[model samples]
Target chain A: MSAVMAESCLTRNEWICGEYLRTRSEELTDATVEHVTITLVAIALALLVAFPLALLARRWRLAAGPILSLTTVLYTVPSLAMYALLLPVFGISVSVVVCGLVLYSLTILVRNIMTGLDSVPDEAREAARGMGYGCARLLFGVELPLALPSLMAGVRIATVSAVSLTTVGAIVDHGGLGNLIYTGMDSYFKAQVLTASVLCVLLAIAADVLLLGAQRLLTPWTRAGRRAGRRRTAGIPRDSVMDAPGTVV
Target chain B: MGVLPDTWTWLTTAEHWSGDGGVWARLSEHLYLTGVCLALACAIALPLAMWLGHGGGRRFGGALAINISNAGRAVPTFAVLVLLSLGPLGDHGDLPTIVALVLFAVPPLLTNAYVGLSEADKDVVEAARGMGMSRRQLLARVEVPLAFPLIMTGVRTAAVQVVATATLAALAAGGGLGRIITAGFATYDTAQVVAGAVVVAVLALLVEGVLALAQRLFDPGHHRRRALAAAPATAVPARTAP
Candidate 1:
């Protein structure tokens, strides 16, 4: 059954690729690059908007709850609906794509930033203030650096989610990896579909690993826990593994 | 009414609720699709998560499992639905749709379960073992129960995702609330779109509320009124001594 399916997909691809392999490959590569670039830009925009607002929200509980809740509500709206809503205002262009992706990233980003900032021990803040550091200086000098790990966690989640949602923009002729999936689906081209699907899955994995590596490089604190986790697992029995400290029970 | 002209007409239409089928029938089908997909996801992901969590010296394998799940998370549901439909799975009615939904749901469930179980308290596990509990007993009685809250968090996230993504099933000829939204979009019928959107949002909220209640029931500490009933007598004393 697997062989037959593979043969059928290959035959279908051969039929579609009659004389356009070069062109199609170029298109596919271009789509992948375009998707990545647009998604990164959206995430950057989200971080810019969300980080400050999240910090401000932390200081004032009144602002924090409503802002965070609003972002959560926005997050719940489906990507398709968000794109459709944007079309009227931004039209079928990069603007619509960017707006949709950025909005989606905000909820995760804001929540993470706020949580990270709040995670900074209160005593640290008091000490900074006692030393004559102003609020802005304290936030920039003390809070931000300590909050890096949590902030990166949010960024990682946002980036992956953005990459996934970028495919949806294909519905409006905004070319991306999703466009490849869409074309394959419309024409019932199995090989094209499979290739695109496999690439997407790989892209997600690669992006995640890269982000994880980046997290380790930037946040040294987590490295000890990760290393400890590794040592505890090495040569350990399955049952003994659970007894390792910091292993979630 | 004036502001939402499209939504106003849709709310008044017979087709919105009862042209070919009654409201109950339409809703039942939608709920059915959502329920089956979520259930299948839970069945697959729960065990997978448990195995990965318990599987030691296999951190690389665990990371691979998580990476696979993260990949699933990154693929848009509609794109997966399209891929499955165009592939060999197309021969099965709504099978592709269910498969895509399951794929979509699995990542969160598996990741959360593994993370939750792996994060289980070490002292608790030691205590259970010191008390002479077997590996199976430790897992079943202590680890799983303690991990329940985090597992529920994964389920909650997965549930919301499934509810929202199931709308794409309409594109694959599987009946769900998405059909209305898609149809509404094609014809520029804002009312139909509004009706569908409203129903889906309400359905999502309903599911969330039900799950929230379930979570509260499962979590003894969530119910403020039951605080006195659920707390162990030694907790306060233990904290005070420290």
Candidate 2:
């Protein structure tokens, strides 16, 4: 589209141009940083909030119905709607994006947390009781460790989703790569749009793979149990529960 | 509270419901885009995934197809829509958006269809085969029926996601209810933005509820599942959150 067409891919506005990277290195780096920061912060906040909510649901069965339903309904709200719903209170800030993500993450995080807690075999609790371990010790030492795989799996799903969702934040002027992608699309900046999008995807995959490795490292016994060939997955944490209703919206 | 009353007024105003950017037009656009993408996705994914699930899963081609579909889910819909609209397909109105959305919607259907059939009862499949049923007959009479519930679930999930993403896609030169919200933003019409969001949310939930009803009504073993759910001996205590 430009007069300097003979220069190279940059002049040609090619989608796969490498010059976009050379010219926009700092810009890409800044967006990537913001994206990663928001994603990690949202997930951490969600985990902090969801664990107690899950425990509350477990401890008080009466509250379980309402707590679970509320989150599920929240999940059903589209992210765009969720953000728009939140913007009134947060006043068009990054908090709106983060809060929206945390709310969205709750349905999965809370459900998975409860599932992990529920899956702790009664016999293990009994054995811990037999050992004279106190309630706190029992929860932290036995229960949480046993539930690590499920909890980690939930975090993995939540993180990947958060990365995808952070792109939607661009509408609010904070969506890391999303900002680049949207602006690029406006002027038909092919290289910028493609590069930013590819970067966004790579970010999600990287987050997922990182979490998977962390799950393995933390739940070593899952691997050990599998290796020992004891009942073929009875003792192992099934992080393979990919039945997560991946609303990539 | 400030935004709420204005939003109510915005929604209540008949003028807001009939114009170019009105709720009716944007909504019809949203639904039209959603329906077309869903139909295309199902057309491309269901039969292939089902076939792979029935008799081809162990082969490399089948696995490759399944993996590719699953991998497609990781690409953000916003990015896809933007790039697609800006690409060679730019001049074709709604074509780029439809292509992006259809690509977006396929993965869930494929995975669900394939997984559902693969999970068909091996014992029941064998019994059907022993009764001298041909492979095609066994897949049709046994496997497909068994997997019907899950396939329906896949459809529900996909529809809901498409609706939500379509709303966002409108921000990046795409169309739908999202356009109303984006337009509201452009004009600093807070009430319109909030009202538009409310309508989109309601639409998403409506689609979800209707599909869930369909899943329940159309499932082949819906009665059996209901019976089992009612049976005390086999009944589980707590609900499994999706």
Candidate 3:
């Protein structure tokens, strides 16, 4: 509270204080690492669960409605509600947040994965079958590769969303930078609040750019001039990702 | 006490339904905040995006606006909520929550509204122009009407999100059903928290359903054909260079 200290934005608790960033770099880094870890794990988990579920929906046809409806319902659930609903099962661990994110993301992932599979040309599937390819071979070799663009699109949305939602995990004490944010909120620490939130946004945008790059690498045929097999045209535009309740259509 | 029956009892209790802290009070607060935020978002985003989409140097400027708004999606709702509440814009009260939610809601509105307007059947737009319709006439008579569904989709999307995240307003001393959840968290009352979650989820889904129904019922898609069921831009013969 000295005059000299008050002259600094950090001691004055002002936002945009570079001093806070310098002094709290370690804490910030740790929170960021935790945030990134939670996001990666949730996206990976959701993909694992979603592929089987998407296949089931595609296979049974009848199961498709219920699977989609359930995921959409899950998407509609507020993050707070979703977290609370899971706390009983996961019991105050980061898993509760991860579980909630995975469920929340299912709507987007399953829909995109389904769309990807459907976009695979019947001729390709028929040709694979004509060549004596079995169901697994057709799915693994022919359909999935063709479905890459859409699937990658789904992953990008789900990943961005997971990054954003991970902050809410702070309520339970595991929210990485979310912890700093909430603590800052409680204490009215302007620098912590502003810094943590900016980092979270930067993290989300960075994840999105990274995924877009990954999509390009994975599906090189989709490179600019070719534009042959990218099949994201059916539902709502994919341009608006993050926090969107996927294709309510 | 949060076992199924306990939550049932908690919901049924008169005490939980009728005070400043009651479900009814908080629900209204939540709804009021949601209503105001959605209206503000629509007012700001729809006009600006539509103008940009219609003609305002729509090629470069429109894309820039759309890209900027789309980038807006990367900003987390919670962070904005907390930042506004705790940062320079607000020290306390609903100002932060309102500002944050409006900002959170604008991007979808902008993206959808612009897409809806710009992507309105190009033929219909041209026909309207051919008929000597002024730009205003074409936009109002042809474009806005055509874009209604997508525009409303934006509204619905924004509304559901506001309902879901408005609960976070509780963190900022703003009133909303989120208070119910936070209060339960504060007290470690499992049943109360469970009840709050159930209500918020129901509200969000209900908003989504109602809006979907409205979009279906109200969209006057009179002259607009789905246009050869045009598959996305993928099939459109590449635009010949000017």
Candidate 4:
């Protein structure tokens, strides 16, 4: 252990070390692009599949149980193990990484979309139906809009987790920031590892924050309702209000 | 499949299970890494989350802690492991890996425990307080007990995650089942890699199953629900509210 420490410490001392100068910014940029591509593609595919599945589950309550259980089981499979399992079929390709990531995102996405759809107020549905709105029209116009907040939260979670999980795909050379980390580990390049790891974390945070902003921008009423909720629940204590129905936060 | 027989041969061979880098040794190392990190995380997170849930109120600090931990979920485990292992914390054997895994484990454990306690029926809590229970008593006897299922769920989630992730320890020169997979990759031995993955998958499933069973056993309310569902006559109660 001491030898290990001595080697690394000698390799890259702190207190404003010049290790950062050793890293290639252009390589970091390329890695960032790859990371974003993998994350976006996986999330998009998961969302596409999840929306329809969520609708089906919402349409049939019994189906919801089985579908959710299946997804949860899939979700429990470790990222590395899943990737390894897929290796036999996909053979270290981008498809394997994206497929594994999409599977991971599905449970969260489907559950959230279903819950969001469930949370659409009944009176709004009644109003839509009374106005001769067809099921499809109501879902597109009324139900989906109201479900935006929860759906956005789910998307934020799915996207961020996808970004993180993409790092694991580096083992297969999926061309992401993980590649940097892997190569760094192989060569014992401390600068390369630190740069890549920090960038991955930063990218995740940036994506999460961006999604949060987008959710706020899209759902004005949620923010308004939250303020109104705060005013109405002012007299009550904190924990009690937390349990209140329809409390956004 | 072509891979299965080869994987079986690799798994069953005594050579694969014997030696410093063998499955048994590696599995023990993996378990040790998981066990230590998980214990450390639970010790730190459980009480803090429970306290925050039971009495810390809805302060900004508590909310901030939960939010930061949730964001921790977004940070890739591999990246953290790599960074820690190559940085100042590097070369400390499994210390870097444990730190990374512990950070990863804390978010779910903390969130679930807090959310579970908060979601415990308010009416039940009121009743407990009405029965002359002190604040501590109310938390311990009523809230924590009520929150057992979700808390156990958190533990199960964290345990499975830790077990699966402990594989990365090999990348940092720390011992674990991951070494088998990595070595297989190095040698282009698909069977060994597949076998290592199978072992990990099975380990994760075992942890999940054990924790789930423990949750059900510890939480009498879950048993009561099972009993109620099992007996149809008792379930409906033979009475009409109408």
Return the top candidate by lDDT: 2
Query: Could you report the DockQ of all the candidates, in the order they appear?
Result: 0.31, 0.56, 0.39, 0.38
Model 3 deviation from the true structure expressed as Cα RMSD, one decimal place = 5.5
| Model 2's interface RMSD | 2.4
Chain B structural similarity as TM-score, candidate 1:
0.85
- In model 4, what lDDT does residue B183 have? 82
The sequence of per-residue lDDT tens digits that candidate 4 reaches over residues B1-242 is 68989999998999999987888888888888889989999998888887777775555435644575557666677867777787778767678988888888887688778877877899999999999999999988989988887788778878877886687666656678888887887888888888988887788778888888888788958867777778766344542211
Query: Residue A115's C-alpha lDDT in candidate 2?
Result: 79
The residue ranges of model 3 lying beyond 4 angstroms of the native Cα positions read: A1-8, A224-249, B65-69, B222-242
Model 2 clash number: 0
TM-score of chain A of 4: 0.85
lDDT of 4 by residue, A1-249 (tens): 877656543355442334354446778888899999999999999999999999998777689899998887777777777778787778879988899888888888898888788878788988999999998999999999998977887887778778888888876898499898888887877767777777887888899889989989988888877887876633322221121111000
Residue pairs with clashing backbones, model 3: A170-A175
Which digits, one per residue and each the tens of the lDDT, describe model 2 over residues B17-57?
Answer: 99887889999999999999999999998887866777655
- Candidate 1 chain B has its poorest 10 consecutive residues by lDDT at B233-242
Better of 2 and 3 by DockQ: 2
